[model samples]
Every structure is written in structure tokens, then in C-alpha cells.
Target: MTISGEFLAFISLALVAVIGGVLLLNLTKVVHMVVGLVFTFIAIAGIYILLSAEFLAVVQILIYSGAITIIMLFGIMLTRHNDEESDSKGGGWKKVLLFLGVLAFGAAFYIGIYNLDFGTEPAALHEKNTEQLGVALYSDFVIPFELMSVLLLVALVGAIVLSRNDGEKEGDKE
Candidate 1:
């Protein structure tokens, strides 16, 4: 088939996202993983822009790439882990089993998706994407949104408590 600019852009963004995810999972260093995750998030934001959802693109950049990355970096700085240590304690059979399990799950998911048919009359696409999103967030999805806020608040408190414990331990040593 013929490749258009939009198709090329989409393929490039998808490759970047996939590569970034692989890097994030395989990276040993905390900072490197964060960088990989940032790459993935930025690619997702690009995809959102390509879809003509400018508001979603901005939100993805601001929330995922900006705020979430900063928060993770801060959390990394606050916590202590051995830089030179590696976690490779396992058996070969475990890896084999895990790989097989993943393959099984993928097969199941593929079969499930392949069998589905959403009847062929295409629904009208939403116009004014930002307005629709805002209305949905406030009206239908408000409870879930508020719950997410509460979860974030709890995570912040947990981080503080962890840092404080480390400080107290250091003080005892001194």
C-alpha cells in the first residue's frame, strides 16, 4: 500500500513508544528508566496530537511527561537503593514458565479481540473534544477523578513517612 505523511508519523510514534517501553523495562538504572518512560509518554502525546485531540495531547504532556516524571524523580531522590546492586536471583525454569504464560495470555487476548464485531454503521465522531472531555469528567467520571486525587494524596503522605523514617535511622547512626 501507499504510505502518507500521517501514516509515517503514526508508525514512527508507535515505534518510539514500543522502544521506549522496552528500554524502560530493561534499564538497570533508575534515572535511565525514568528517561525511557519520558520518551514513551512524549510519543503518546504526539499520537494524541495526531488524533486531533490537542487538549489530550497537552494534558498527556503536562500530567504524564511533566508532573508524573517530576514526582518519580523526586521519589527516587528521597528513597535509598543500592546503586551497584543487581537483582538476578532466580532459576531458568521460572523464566521459561513466565515466557510461556505471557504467550498464553497473548493468544487468549488475540482470540477474544478477533471474535468481536462492533456492527458496521460507524458512529459520528465527537466534535469539540475538549468540551466533551470536560463535561464527561465532571458529570460521569467525577467519582473516579476524585478517587484518583485521594490516591495521589495518600501516596504523597506515604512518601513523606518513608523519608522521615530514613532520616530518623540516619540520626540514630550519627
Candidate 2:
């Protein structure tokens, strides 16, 4: 079988996503890690678009790549942290072990699913997906969605209050 453009795109996006995740885990700086996370988020959004979920792709980009990453950056800037790097004598060995473990898991997963066939045709779920999503979300999941929003708001307020208290304590000692 010949390689299709869609398959190539998927492979590229998946590779980028995996690389971003690895960078996020291995990076030393908080800002760098956030950048890696943004890369991963954007790649995932691309995959969503490839799968014809335009609404979900846009939401992924906006919510994850834009809002969440910005919030994380702001948190990193507002928090006090030391710029010193700790000496890790055994870090190299840990990295090697982690790499081997990841490879083993990947091989196992690939072997398990390589020859498996679902024998199913693709459904036209992309048609009216946004409308369907909106209807389901607003009608069936309205209460849960509103509750989640309120919970997030409370968490944001609590974070601000706690940070302000910490700032006041620092002022007291000065």
C-alpha cells in the first residue's frame, strides 16, 4: 500500500506531540516546559482537525495552547523560585532506564494492535458535529458544565487569595 498524505500528516503530528512531551519532561526551566506543552497541544489540535473535529480542534488550541499555557506562564512568573540547578549524579542512568521502558511499552503496544482489524466503516460524524456537541453539552450536561465553571472560578479566587496572603507575610518579615 502507498503512503497517503493524511497518513503522513498524522505521523508528523504524532511525532511532534511525542517529542514535545519528552521535552516537557526533560526540560530544566519551567517556561521551557510550558513551551513544550504548547507544542504538544498544537500538534494534538492538528490531529483533531485531521479527524474532522474542527470544533474540538479549535477548542483544544484555544483552551490548551492559548489560555492554559498563558496561565501557567503567569503562575511561573508570579511564584518565587530559585534559579539554581541541583547536581544529579545518577540522572544519566535514570534517563537510560526511562528510555528503555518507553521503548518496551511502545513495542508491546504496536505488536498487540498491528494485525488487529476493527472491520468498520468511517461514520459521517463530522457532519453537524459542532451543533450536536452544543446541543448535547447545553441540554444533557448543562448542570455539570456550569458546576465545573463555578468550581474553576472558586479555585482561581482561592489561588489569588493565597498568593496575596503569602505576599503579605513576606512584607511582614521585611
For all candidates in order, the CA lDDT equals 0.89, 0.93
Per-residue alpha-carbon lDDT of candidate 2 for residues 1-174, written as tens digits (9 for 90 to 100): 899999999999999999999999988898999999999999999999999999999999999999999989988998898767899899889999999999999999999999999889887786899998899999999999999999999998997777675547655785
TM-score, structure 2 vs. true = 0.84
Our model 2 lands, by Cα RMSD against the true structure, at 3.5
Off by over 4 Å in 1: 85-116, 161-174
Clashing residue pairs for model 1: none
Global local distance difference test of model 1:
0.89
Model 1 poorest ten-residue lDDT run: 162-171
Q: Give per-model TM-scores.
A: 0.72, 0.84
Q: What lDDT does model 2 reach?
A: 0.93
Top candidate when judged by TM-score against the true structure: 2
